[model samples]
Every structure is written in C-alpha cells, then in structure tokens.
Target: MKSVILSSVLPLATVITAVVGIAGAASAAEPDKQFFQSAEGKWIGPGEIVAGKYKGTKFNCSFTGSTPDGKVGMSLDGGCRVGMFTQQMSAKIERKGREGYKGSFMGGATGSGLDIIGGNVVDARKVVFTINRNQLRGVMQARIPDDNSMTVTIAVRVDDQLVPVIGMSLKRVDAVEVGSIAPN
Candidate 1:
C-alpha cells in the first residue's frame, strides 16, 4: 500500500502549500504596507497659531528624511512668540496599527533645552505629534479630485492637558520615506 500512502501524502502537502501561499499574499496586502510605503520622502508645511495669543503667525517646518532604523529627522523654523527659534530634531516612528504611529522625539528648540521625547500619529494624509505635553497636529487632505496634492492642517496644544494652542494649514506636501534598516 506504499503507492496509496504516497498519493494521500502528496495531495495533503499540495493543499498545505497553497493555503500558506495565500496567507502570505494576504499579509503582504495589508493596509499598513501602504503607510510603510507612502511614508517615504520629505514633507514640508507651514505652522500657524490657531487658539492661543499667537494665533496668526506663520512658521515653517519639515520632516527631512526617514531612515531604515525607523528614525525621522525634523527641523522647525520660527513659530514662536517670545523669540525666533530654529530646531534640529530626530525621532523614531513606527506604525502601531490602523493609521497610528508611536515614537520618541529628542531635539533642541531655539533658545531652550534641547532634549524632548514624544509620540506621533500618522495616516494616509495626516500626522500628529506631541512634545512634553505640547501637541503638533497636521492633517493632509487631497487638493485636486484626481491629483496627488494634499491640503495640510497643523495644530498645537499649549497646556499639560493637550489643549489646542495653535493651528495652521498647508498644501501640496510630499510623503515621508520608509525602508528597511541598513547594516551598521
């Protein structure tokens, strides 16, 4: 009965392989893959004060680049009330699930202490982050119905309870870059 046993085993193996292959493909098609892909590049926009005393000033900021190690470099110019400020910052960002990312930011704000840690959130067209109880929120919506351009909205929280301190809008910013970590 060796031939009979061999036939049964072969069919079972074929079925198992097919099932595994389909499962692998489905995982690869997950929505998070899109975020990981679209998140590669540079994004720049203007910062505005919406809710606080500094409600009308405009500032510039950018996410310079993203590394394979999940870190992103950020720079901010202006957007302060008391003094002119420029900042050089770096942070690691990762997709948590369904339009969410969590990471830590550490950098210097002009004329102030240089170390800070916070978490960030991102979706297909929006990004939000917080530093030391202060929040920076940005939303990107499509510009043209068929084009890739997006309108971006940015807001900040001024207090410990995460209140909205300021807000601004920007348009046509690029996406963030993402990739696998390189060998150190």
Candidate 2:
C-alpha cells in the first residue's frame, strides 16, 4: 500500500514541475517585448563636445529611431555655429540583435567617418554604441531617465585612453510609428 502511494505522488510531482517550468519561461519572455516598446521614439536636444578640438562648443542634437520586436535603427544629427567654427555631424544605425546595432558616423565638414561596429540598449533605458577601427576607437552612451528626458555621453580613445568627447541632455518631443512609410 505504501509503494502504491509513493508511485502516485511522484507522477503528480513531475507534472507540477513541468507546468511550473513552462510558466516561468513565459514570464521571462514578457520583458523582451516590454523593453522593445519602451525604447522607440524621437528625441531632441542641445549637446556639447567635451574633449576634442571642439571642446566647450555647443550643438543642437536630434535622434530618431524605432526598435520594434527587437529590430532597431536610428539616425542622429548635430550642428553647431560658433563664428568661424561651424560644423555638422551625422550617424546611421541598424540593429544586429535585441540590443545590438551596426552603423556609421560621418562628419560633414571634414568628410571623415568611422564604422559603428557594435551597439546595445540595456533594460530599455540605457543605450551604448561602440566603434573600433584603425585609429578610431570610441563609445557613445545614452540613457532615458523618463518618458520626457534623456542624457548622452560620447567618449573617444586618445593616447591609448578613453576620453569623453560629447555630453548631451535631450527631450522627447515626438513619438514615431515604427513601420510607417512616407508618401513620396
């Protein structure tokens, strides 16, 4: 009688364990969708280059992007006019994974550019982009503190060390539809 009871209890335990494991996996997947949605939008603000030839100079910066279903892409541009030191810079990004991207950065004045080798969005709030090629190695990070505000930091390698080059504060003035096409 005791053996019969033990056999029945063991099967019930196995069933319970399987059900619980499946439920846990489903819950684990919820954050991936939430994080993807939370990071899509258009953000704009003024920023300053902190550690280069243009240190202390200010520029108007704007970033626009969509990261839906783990697909990410964004475009960033900045321009500054400081009496004989005007400049424009731009970059384009496309996602490589849930938190990864590939892009390029270009300076309009010098026409110099670098390849963006890797990038990632973390916890739907913080973002990072990195570049490493030839003489250029740098990282750019941005964080959205709230629905309305964001901060950015850019660092470049100089003399074998990473140096901060741009720091920015941004505001979200608009939201973008992820898959809309413009009528041409």
Candidate 3:
C-alpha cells in the first residue's frame, strides 16, 4: 500500500521537491543556487512563436541574468523586438518558505503578465515554473544546454494538454562559450 501511494505521488513530488522552500535534503545533491549563479551574464539570440495564432512570428532578444547575493534564485531582465516593436521581458524567481518557488514575469498576473506561483528545479540542466493568468495556466521551462546557451519554452494548457506558444533561444554574448538560448 505504501509503495503504491509513493508511486502515485512521485510525479508531482519530482517537480515540487522544495523549489519553493529553503534549501533542503531534496536539493542537497543538486547545485540549485550554483545553477542560478552560473546562469548570470548577458544573453542575445532569436526565437519564434511556433504555435497558436501568433505562430511564425520571429523576434530577437537580449537579457541580463543575475542571482541575488546569498540567495537561491535568479532574475532575468531584458526585452525582445519584433520588427520595430519592442517588448520588455523580465522574470524573477526565488526560493521561499520550505516548499517551492515564487516570482513573476512581464508583470504579475494582476498587471499585464502572468504569475509564477510554483516551481521546481528538475535537474542541473533544467528548471520548470508554473505560470498562471486568469483561467489560462501554463508551464515555463528554462534549460541550459551548455555554459554559453539557454533555451526557454512556454506552454499553455489546451484542453487536456500543454501546447507550446512561445520559444526563445539566447546565446551568451558576454561570456566565453559558443551557444544559443530561449526566453519565457
């Protein structure tokens, strides 16, 4: 019985393994804070909206990533440009309490953007955040494929599945690495 219960909870547990909390046993083996620190520096790259009505829209972006001193989170601030139009891009995620992560993007769900209500560090190379606005819910993943590149994808819940809506690929323009990345 215990085995069956543990099996059923493992999936959710995998993601909620204390990304919202103080650094604990769940993340002891993973350098969650180091991951954020390593992600610092300026990034530049291109991306496309691969799905939804905005599909095929292409844009370029530049951002600066930083981690608060003595903290286990990161803040990404920058903007994207589509033709002559420019959109400011910003996100901040910090570990809180003894549970999971919390932060915002563009702005909070109350302003013009979505709220990052919860999240977890999946591994050394990937972290997943849950975003919500009104009735629309989504998941954002930031994956660092190498020291010089990061990729971000936002997928919204469609019916019973999550569909990719926005993708960003960024390269470390200020660091010494040949790579590309994405934004939320």
Top TM-score hit? 3
Instruction: Give the C-alpha miss distance for residue 13 in model 2, angstroms.
Output: 55
Q: How many clashes in candidate 3?
A: 12
lDDT of each: 0.30, 0.46, 0.60
- For candidate 3, give the lDDT of residue 113: 60
Clashes of each: 9, 1, 12
- Tens digits of per-residue lDDT for model 1, 1-184: 2222112211111111111111012253343333333333343455444444445545554443332433222222212121366544344344444444333333222212211233232333333333331223322111211122223332223344444333323232444212432212
Give the distance in Å from residue 26's predicted Cα in candidate 2 to where it truly belongs.
13
For model 2, how does the per-residue alpha-carbon lDDT over 1-184 read when each residue is reduced to its tens digit?
Answer: 2221112211111111111111012244343333334434555567665654455766564444343233345444443333455445445555554444566655211234556676555555565667644555667666657656667676667788887766667666564443231212
Give candidate 2 regions above 4 Å deviation: 1-39, 67-70, 75-90, 97-100, 107-111, 175-184
Per-model TM-score on C-alpha atoms:
0.42, 0.59, 0.78
RMSD (Cα, Å) of model 3? 10.6
Q: Between candidates 1 and 2, name the one with more favorable TM-score.
A: 2
lDDT of 3 by residue, 84-143 (tens): 977666766777756567876655667656677887777776778887767777787777
Q: Ten residues in a row with the worst lDDT in model 2? A: 15-24
Cα displacement (angstroms), candidate 1, residue 7, comes to 70
lDDT of 2: 0.46
User: Model 1 Cα displacement at 155 (Å)?
Assistant: 5.5
